[model samples]
Target: MNTSTSGTTKNYRVLLVGDEDNSARLILNTLHKVGLECRYAVGAAAGLSAFRENNIHLVLLDLSTPTAETLCARIRENSTKPLLMTTAATDHQVPLIGLKVGADDYLLKPLDPPMLIARVFALLRRVYVYGGDESHVAKAPPSYSDQGSRLPEGWATCEACNYMGPSPRFEGRSRHGQSVMVCPHCRVPAAVTYAVS
Candidate 1:
């Protein structure tokens, strides 16, 4: 899975919260294959502490952990970062409650590595790449904008045609709910910007 866009690879950090060390290791190995860095926490307290102390970009929570729900809710209160949950329980309500408490996605354990990787990538793309929330981007240094660029802050330079203008000039959304900016000059989806409230 090449997670790069526009020839740049994002160094996204993931936090794995669970008591199951073997499961956590498995997940870390899978994510590492695609260039994601991960941190592991054995319980809710440790998870919360790690989340606060580190520059975590996303979270993978094992719902079977006794305190998973509490950790999930607390993390949601602190940040809008994507949270993916996994559990072995077949009870549908377990996942339902997890979502209600703020998980972005849930999976059943005896986990499928491919599906897990896909979901992680999807959430990262939606929230960090195409979603374009300034809060998330602010943590990472500017990758596109550079000191030599004449474009003003909040302006976008089209990747396809070099059309430069305020982000609104290229504003639009994709059918999948991604916030995309289409280049008016070349009719290509060119950029993503934080939507002003």
Candidate 2:
């Protein structure tokens, strides 16, 4: 299903890091069904470089890739973007280690497409749609009241400080020139159309 908010079309970029071409193709195909643009990196180094060079909203790291743990740690150190680890190994410790290294979630290999899509969507919703705070219900921006173009008050959460409360409507432009809502509390750009195509 398309995850865009009502009355808005948002895009997100996903980085798939792995050495297995077949697995990458499968994962990319699954994600594309839901409108996410994906980039594939062959190994840890390439993955790290691609992530650094692009606006990657999420990362899917394959445990089979060499030095995947190091890549996870490196990515986590650099950004708060969501990371998911996939593996064929059933050892419980593998997922634990992946989590310890900063994966937000993990899945087994021979991947189930539906479950994969669900997890990816859930993470994107939690981070971008809800501004990283799950407690608040999403509300559409207030429409112009009878005052002729005057917008009613609105609420926003600062992705930096976790601040959530009411404020006047604050709008800005993203690096990609997309209109976004700025966080009043910290003056940081808070929400935007998330797709990166």
Candidate 3:
């Protein structure tokens, strides 16, 4: 079954693909509480159709979905929005496979409300507000050196989303390699600078 339910406003939209009635209802309820609109589809065909027909900001998929991978690939072809997958299986490989195929994040279900909200917020923060860009400037801790110089600290601000964080993101070499600290709310790569009073 395919159903598109009207939500509060157009500020955000979600495409949910699954056949599990209880899980879908729980998710839809959570999304509605936060003022997000959702469109639900029971299988891959409906999911693909809805995705193409709507202006969706994120996709929440069930790993048990038939042709889950194919559906993800099809969605990725046109949209850059975040895709999150959930699974009931405990096997460690399931989430990995979802990530390998195209999912931006994976979750094990019997859904935890707080975790679900947090992940959704994080994804929405990055995709909708930041669009995966590092152009925004943020404040940094004075003790932190960025490119050898101590940057002035104040706050990292995203003009597009009005997101503010305590520290600007910084780039550094980790054991694994170089990694940049991104704003949790906007995903902007920030610089390490001293906080300005």
Lowest summed lDDT over 10 consecutive residues: which window, candidate 2?
143-152
The digit string of per-residue lDDT tens for model 3 on 84-124 reads 99999898988888888789998888997646755775677
What tens-digit string does per-residue lDDT give for candidate 2 at 14-95? 8899985687888887676556667888899989988898677889999889999999999988798889999999789988
Q: Measured by C-alpha RMSD in angstroms, how accurate is candidate 2?
A: 13.9
- TM-score, model 3 to reference: 0.66
TM-score of each: 0.64, 0.62, 0.66
Model 3 residue runs over 4 Å out of place are: 132-197
Residue 32 alpha-carbon offset, candidate 3, angstroms: 0.8
Off by over 4 Å in 1: 1-10, 134-197
Ranking by lDDT: 1, 2, 3
Model 3: residue 195 alpha-carbon error in angstroms? 25
User: Candidate 1: worst 10 consecutive residues by lDDT?
Assistant: 1-10
What is the overall TM-score of model 2 with all chains considered together?
Answer: 0.62
Per-candidate clashes, comma-separated: 0, 3, 10
Give per-residue lDDT, candidate 1, residue 175.
91
